[model samples]
Target chain A: MLPAAALLLVFLTYPLGLGVWLGFTDARIGRPGIFIGIENYEYLWSDAVFWLSVFNTLLYTISASILKFALGLWLALILNQNLPFKSFFRAIVLLPWVVPTVLSAIAFWWIYDSQFSILSWALQQMGLIDHRINFLGDPENARASVIAANVWRGIPFVAITLLAGLQTIPQSLYEAATLDGASRWQLFRYVTLPLLTPIIAITMTFSVLFTFTDFQLIYVLTRGGPVNATHLMATLSFQRGISGGQLGEGAAIAVAMIPFLLAAILFSYFGLQRRKWQQGGGD
Target chain B: MASVAIDEVYKSFGAVEILHGVSVNIEDGEFVTLVGPSGCGKSTLLRMIAGLEKISRGQIAIGERVVNNVAPKERDVAMVFQNYALYPHMTVAENMAFSLMLKGVSKPESDAGVRRAAEILGLVPLLARYPRQLSGGQRQRVAMGRAIVRDPAVFLFDEPLSNLDAKLRVQMRAEIKELHQRLKTTTVYVTHDQIEAMTMADKIVVMHDGIVEQIGPPLELYDRPNNLFVASFIGSPAMNLLRGEIATGGSPSFRGAGGISVPLASALSIPNGEPVVLGIRPEHLRLSDDQGIPVIVAVVEPTGSEVQLIGRTAGGEEIVANFRERHSFTPGETIRLTAEPSLIHLFHGETGQRFQTRTDQ
Candidate 1:
């Protein structure tokens, strides 16, 4: 316990305190400046790009989380069935989640290449379009592309976690439900959904929190491109503090994401507690 | 309640068959039990009747319809699983009303069904609580309540009392029998316990190695078992069997392995020196004076009412006897035991089938 506390203090609490301190100073890339209270936050409040990044973060987190949940639950349900080659398929389904996000985003970047994209080439050859599709050049397309990429990368995590939760439910419950005259859809709605709610809450919360502050995928794919249309708070913070030489403003932007993360974590915590209480409590 | 017919049903998984051409006719409101040791295919037969398992061949009919291809829900049968299979998320009332709600019953009707079942199972006080909050016996009643709410054509029990403790098992056993009497449902219960079958079943189907060995009322199976398996499987303390031969001369008698001559039925028509196995219940053998089989007492256990003595015959064959009159016999002390000729069971040595005894006794 002492070791864990020490590690968390050294790696987590100290860095968080340092970031907050940095946010209050006029720190630059190489040299530290005098303390400037609320200056960076005041500038960020009126900065149109910062507000746009916040909007982008919200849009990306919400859409990507929803899509990830839908697709991942579908995959989990499919995996949950009694099919041949089951373990092999489970291993294959988890590959996207296991691989590094940046590497997959690099692959996506190639797939969405403006001039030599395979998607555009396939569409062109099919005679469905006359011009090459600019997947990342347009603002809306870039936002869609990054969110889609995030969903694709996040799906396996959600699916695997939800699959584990799905397995913990006894087969007898399904048998009982079947004997209760429940149709397939009603069984899913009444039995599977309610039983899966706690895990779904947890997995989607982590998905939302991660997608909200996601950086590597956006950095590799669009780099907040198409006129800052896909700049998540994380990517914008990295660009401002590390590359744009405004460490104080970047730290401020990074620190601003705490409230949303805390909200997601708290939602998951309460969901789990409710689950415990529903399971008859400590008695 | 509807009658259930399981005719020549077979269940196979891959290349291995678990139930082989089993058939049993359950009358309406009859409580039939399938009793055997583990891996005896009793539970599988019950599952097949419940439509949980597909019958590999032959037909199963509930009331009039052949429900071989019917889904579990369409079969109108409810099962009480060994683990109770209660939904952890739902409250007790919700769990009991789940089936009625699935049938699109009105909310009031569903609540009424659940309330009636709860009242019947003594679960009225626990109606709002979850299953996990209840004790084992209460959970067991809730499982029954879930089945009771359905008003099913038949009730299937798969070793439902095996999970409870000893005293609780006996209590639940009586409760389940009483429930069957009260509801008068056509019930098919599966258990590996012979005593439960004897107590609860109107007709007990004794199965061994996937085939029905014998089907009869409990006492009939106990008194006149057709095969060696049935004779040995029924009854607590089990009937003691000894290999012997029928004496060829007049005043025919059974000359057992240890030179113990037990009086055979007076009206007998059997060849001389015919090898046979003699079966005697522990309670049937009693202490006698001089003219009886000599035994060396090995151990004595008194279960309050009756004294069970484990002894060996002069030939070193183990025999268990339950004596009504208690005696303090030391472990190696010699004693004599005898049984009435009517209490003796004779079986063919080669075939393990019961030998036809003299009728005019």
Candidate 2:
């Protein structure tokens, strides 16, 4: 136990301490040894770009998380039914999560490109758009595109999680509903949805964290591009620390994200606890 | 009041038939129990009546309408399942009121229905509790309350008490009988327990291998079983069977394994050396001083009410007899026993069909 504790202290605690120290110091590219207290934090407070990045990150996280949850639940419900080739369809649904993220992002990039993208080509062909539209060139469209990409990737995880929960429910419950003369919607509303709440809450919490810290897909597709409209906290940290060589400012920005992430985790914790209490108190 | 009639119903899954062509006329306010062992299609037959399973062929009618394809909701039937099938999320009140609410009954009307059913089932205190919060018996009461609230044409029970412990099973069995007596709703119950069938059924349908063996009142079945299956299945500790041959003679004595003889009335006509199986209830065996067969007791089990003796005949065949008092005997004790001639049942060994005794006729 002592040896494992020592290892944890070295590998985890030391790095956290170093990151905190770096957040307060002016650890830039050329002036690496400077230690200026609170300046980096003050700069972050007044930074409009940082605030916009924060807003964009929250928007992407909330939208993508909600979209993934809805789509995943619908897909799970459909797949739970007695259908042909159910196992084959389930395997196909998992492909999005299993593929390499970089490859998927690159493929999506080509599909959303302004001139020769397949989606633009299909839209033009369908006469939905008057001309070939650049999906990622416009700021609003780019943010929406990145969110859609995140949703597409995360949907399989949520669906599989919810499917496992759905399978645990006994078939006798549905039969009981039929005997009670429950309509199709009532069975889902009273039986399926109430039973699935715990699983959905857990999966959505994980999805929020994954969407908030997402870097690879956005980097490969947009690079926080189209006038920095799609930049999340992770992307901005990467640009400041690695690209612009402002390591201290980047560290401060990264550290500023901690309070929001903690707030999210606490919110989820209280929500889950309240539900558990409600269920337990009834008994 | 409603009468349920099943006419020539057959059910099949893929190519394997689970229920053969079957028909039953259940009169209004009668409790009919379908009793059989596992894989006997009794539950399947009950589910067909409840409209839970599709009838592959023939017709079923609840009253005047032929309801071969009517949905369960439209058929006005409520079922109490073996596992109770109470919605885990809903309180007992909500579970009882769910069907009424679905039919767009007013809130007060539904609440009244729920309250009345709860009061009848003695479940008013449990109305606010969910299924997981209730005990097994409480859950069963809630299930019954749910059925009663619907006030449907017929009440169906699919082995609803099978999940309870032994003592609770007995208590609940009586409660169910009392409930039926008060409601007098046409009920079709399914179970694997013959005791339940005997105690609660107005008419018992005995099924075996997806075929009906016999349908009659409990005492009618006990006194006159149509076949070997019904004969052995309807009684507890089962009827003791001894194979012997009946010959044309004056006394018509039966021969046993070790050349032991037992007296029989000359009512049955049998060819010389025709093989037959004789069945006797354990309670019918007597310890007599007259000419009797001697047997070595193999095991003795004594309950306060009766003493059961497992013994082997001189022919090395095992037989069991129950005595009211403790016989106070060790294993291997030799005792002479005889069966009442009128109580003995004879069956053709080949066909497993009973030969009616004079009193039976």
Candidate 3:
């Protein structure tokens, strides 16, 4: 306990207080100014580009989270089936998640290039389009491309966790459902989905939180490019704090993501409690 | 009301066969029990009848319909599992009404069906409660209630009461038997305990090694077993077997290894000097004068109603005697044991098959 407390004070509490304090001052790269309360937050409130960055973060989080859930659940269901070479397939499914995020994001960067991309080359060979597809040129296209990269790297984590959840359900319930005259669809709706709700709640919360504050894939792929169209709060914060050298504003932007994360966690916590109450589960 | 017939059904997994060509004919409203030890394929046979398992060969018919290719949902049979398998998310009413709802039953109609089954099982208060909220015995009743609401043609029970405690098991056993009598559903049950089979089954099929050892009424199997396996398996305290040979001389008698001779009350078709195994139930061995086989009492167990004595005969065969009259014979004391000649059973030594004995009528 002493060691843990000492580590928390030295590493976590001190830095958190310092960052919050820095958000209130006009601290630049080489100079520390007097404490100016609410000045950075006031400027951020009216800045159109700052609001756009918030919008971009919301769009990225919602789209990527929904896609990750749908595809991850599909992969989990397929992995749950009785097939030959099942363990081998499951191990291979986790490759993207196990590899370094920046390394894999580099691969996605090459694939989403405006010219000479393998995807564009394959599409040209199929005659789907006359010109080389500009994957990351337009603002909307860059936003979409970054979200697709995020989903690709995020799917394996969701799939593996949900797969562990699926294996915990007993086979007898399925047999009982089969004998109870439940069709394939009804069996999933009544048995699998309700039983899987808790795990889905947890997995989606983590997915949403990570996508909301994501930095690495966006930094490596777009770098808030195409006129700052896909600059999430995390990337914009990094741009101001480190590259632009406005430490105070960058800390303020980073601090702004807390309320949304709290909302997501509380929503999931209440949803989990409702499930427990409905199932008469233990406290 | 429907009869079930399993005609020479066999099941195999890859290269090893688990159930041999098994057959049984269950009449309408008959409570038949398939009883055996673990790994004897009794549960496998029950699953095959429910269409949960596919038969490798032969046919299973439920009321004239050969359901070999039917799915479990299409077969219209309900099963009570060993673990209950109640859906944890649904209330008791919903768990019971789920099948009817899937059959496109109306809300009021399905509610009425669930209420009727709840009444039959006395689960009215628990209709709004989930499975995890109920006790073991209550959960057991809910599992039966789920099956009852289905109103299927046949009900299958796979060791449904083995999960309960001893007192609860006996109580639930009686409850299941009573439920069968009140509903009169043609039930096929499986259990490893012979007492459950003997007390509850209208007909019992004893299985071992994936094959049917014997099938008969409870008392019939108890009184006249065709082989050594059936003779030993059906009774609570198993029958004692002694290796001996039957003499076909003028005064016919069976002689044991220690040269202890007990005369036969009847004549046998077996030739002289043919090796035979003698079987005698414990209750049949009477306590008499010193004119019978000599033995030393090893232990005495008094169950308030009867004195069960375990003794060793002079030829070194352990014999159990359940005597109605209490005798205060200490251990290492000498005692004489005898049996009425009619109570003795003789089987072929090598074949383990019982031979019929002729008695003067």
lDDT by residue (A1-283, candidate 2, tens digit) is 9999999999999987877788888887888747899998888889888888999999999899889999999999999998999999999999999999999999999988888899878878898988887789899999999999989999999999999989978887888888778879988987899888878878888888888989998899899988889989999998998799988888888888888789889878965664421354232
Residue A99, model 3, lDDT? 92
In candidate 2, residue A258 scores what lDDT?
A: 87
A best-first ranking of the candidates according to their DockQ comes to 3, 1, 2
lDDT of 3 at B227: 85
Q: Of the candidates numbered 2 and 3, which has the greater DockQ value?
A: 3
In candidate 2, the second chain superimposes onto the true chain B with a TM-score of 0.97
The pairs that clash in candidate 3 are none
Classified by CAPRI criteria, candidate 3 counts as: medium
User: Per-residue alpha-carbon lDDT of model 1 for A96-197, expressed as tens digits?
Assistant: 888898899999999999998999999999999999889999999999999988888999999999999999888888888899898899889988999899
Name the candidate, 1 or 2, with the larger lDDT value.
1
- Candidate 1 off by > 4 Å: A281-283, B359-361
Off by over 4 Å in 3: A274-283, B258-260, B291-293, B314-316, B359-361
The top-ranked prediction according to DockQ is 3
